[model samples]
Target: MSEPIRVCVTGAAGQIAYSLLYMIANGDVFGREQKVILTLLDIEPMMGVLEGVVMELSDCAFTLLTQVIPTADPAVAFKDVSVAFLVGAMPRRQGMERKDLLSANVKIFKVQGEALNTYAKKDVKVLVVGNPANTNALICSHYAPTIPKENFTAMTRLDQNRARAQIAQRVGTDISNVQNIIIWGNHSATQFPDVANGTANGKAITDLVDTSYLQSEFIETVQKRGAAVIAARKMSSAMSAAKAAADHVRDWWLGTTGTFVSMGVLSDGSYNIPKDIVFSFPVEIQNKQWKIVQGLNIDEFARGKLDITTKELLEEKEEAMAICNAN
Candidate 1:
């Protein structure tokens, strides 16, 4: 058995962490053979709630959970951590614009980023799960100047999973049948869930479904699925978001098998997206490192979609940068 590792999850008292903790404790992420020390961090006011969550974790009798560190201090939570799930940030409230959320989250991430830089492992893999995630991640990386830009990523896997499910439901096949469904650009409604290169059961998705459906309904549904969930449930997606975060870490750690997966990695000028802003792209993982898949043909329509989403990210990046520069 390998040495035990520390995993940190911020916003430990929140609904998503409530669902996510069990997944990590059960060894769904790092293999069942590996032991994990969970560092659950929330604000000072929420430590009482975190204590209850820790009690529940203790009762689960998971062999892989060797220790649980519950603290309000970023220093304690981030110290020597191997994998950090940055789930703690101010959520968008009623009638809040993206810029408002960006302003709030940038400050939170700046502190966490500094913590990661000062205390975390040099190679710590960070995933930003909060809203305005891509910009938050960019700002986080900006603060942690020593950490590699590739180490920070935002969660667009949720959107990717939704796209796959919609494709499967429409094509009358299992979700696993759809591979390489790319979520281009941001995590918001402007995100373009491109299926141009995706294959369903070794056949082209465009061939399996009508071009019109893929172009119109498929794009709109995947883009607005989160809002639909919020509308129906009166709460944002928690369990599904947790599951996607796990999938992302699992794939990133263990390496991808057959097809490329969607991830919001820092843009490297791929597909004409400007560098610095984290943008979702079709990526393949190998040796615990993710690289954007290259050389896929982008038709005019896909180019237009990418440009639209890139515009949103650029604006978001501007807002986040302004906050960082001020503070």
Candidate 2:
């Protein structure tokens, strides 16, 4: 058996972490054979709550959970960690502009990024799960010069999963039958959930569903699913978000076999997306690395959609960069 690995999760007392910890502890993420030592971090006010969480973890009797360390200090939380889930960020409140929330999280992620650079393992993989996640991840990557740009990613798998489910439902097929559904650009409402190249049971999704609905209703539903969930549940998605995060890391560790999944990684000018900003694209996992799927025929309709979402990401990048420069 391989040695137990340390996994650090920020916002340990929050709803997402509440669901996330158990998944990792039960080997839902690291597989049944690999053991893990969980390093949990939150602010001082949340530490008491975090301790309760630790107690619950201890009570679970998970054979794969070798240790659970709760701390308020970033340095302590991050020390020698292999996989760091930067899941903690300030949520946007009523009457607040998106830029206002971005500024607050910029400072928080900058500090955490510095901590990761100072204390984490050389090849630590960072996944930003908080709101404004793509920008927060870009800020974190900017601050941590030592960590490779490719190692920093934001969670768009949630959007991808939602898109896949929506497509499957529209076509009256099993969810597993939908493949290669792409979520391009940001995690917000502007995101384009494209099924142009997707398949349902080895057939093109466009052939299965009406083109008009695919362009209009399907796109809107997948993009706004989070808000719809909050409207119905009075709370944001937690369990599904946790599951997507786990699947993302799992696919990155294992391989995706040329299957298309969405990940927001710092772009290298692929698909006409500018560099230094993290953007979601149709990607395949191989050799423990993700590469953008190339040579897709983007028709005029897809181009127009990509332009809108790309513009939003560019504006968000400017806001995050302005905050970083000012600080």
Candidate 3:
């Protein structure tokens, strides 16, 4: 058999990983034909939890699974991995300010990033799934200087999926038919879910939906969908999040043709976004590399929404950098 690809998942014992690990092992990200070696990472205290998770995986006896390595050490987790899901981060506790959450996660990502730089394969493709994901991705790439910035991305695919579903429901079409929805800016509530250039079954979304709904209800629903899940379930969205995370890396690994997906990649001054911060944009993947989709006209309404999200991202950048500099 060919050598199995090494894949690492941080926060492997968490709720998200509980669902994600199976998908990775059972050919959700990599193709079913591709063999995989899974490396799972969690804090020392969560090692017990990971043991049960591993046991379940073992019972499944996946034909494509080659190995599973569970560890608390980042260096051990990252070493030689070809693909990484940086899913672990300090969760926001009650009474914690936004800055506090950012600060804690910044420290965690810095350590993991440094480990990734020192041990992970040079070409490792990383997806940041933790909250404050775009800024966390920035901090991770900042510490992992050897890994090209393009290799680090934040998960905005969840937002994109939500937007597509909403558009599909309103227009009464299969969600698959909705294309070109863009989740612009941060992974936070300030992110803009844009359908300005989107189409549903070869027809413009604008032509089907009035501007009032598009400008208000549709935008807010996608942006606040996470909160809605939390309010109803009394916990965050895990199953859907894990699914989206898997879909994200799967698309990135295999590459997408004739369509684009939303990903938070490092900005290179594209579409008036400032350079170096991780901003979500509509991107097309080819040959395992992604290029941001260009030439979509940003009208006045779209430009204003973009600016709002951009401001939030810049504020997030400043806050994260301040915390990093202090440490």
TM-score per candidate, in order? 0.98, 0.98, 0.98
Off by over 4 Å in 2: none
lDDT of 3 by residue, 28-140 (tens): 88998889999999999999999999999999999999899999998899989999998888888889998999999998999999999999999999999998999999999
**lDDT scores of the candidates, listed in order:** 0.93, 0.90, 0.93
Candidate 1 lDDT, 1-327, residue by residue in tens? 688999999999999999999999999999899999999999999999999999999999999999999999999999999999998889888899877888888889989999999999999999999988888899999999989989999999999999999999988998878899999999999999999899888899988899988999999999999999999999989999999999999999999987889999998898788988899999999999999999999999999999999999999988888888888
The superposed Cα distance between candidate 3 and the true structure at residue 327, in angstroms, equals 1.4
lDDT of 1 at 100: 84
Residue clash pairs of candidate 2: none
lDDT of 2 at 137: 92
Residue-level lDDT tens digits of model 2 in 204-229: 99888998899998888898899999
Regions of candidate 3 where Cα sits further than 4 Å from its true position: none
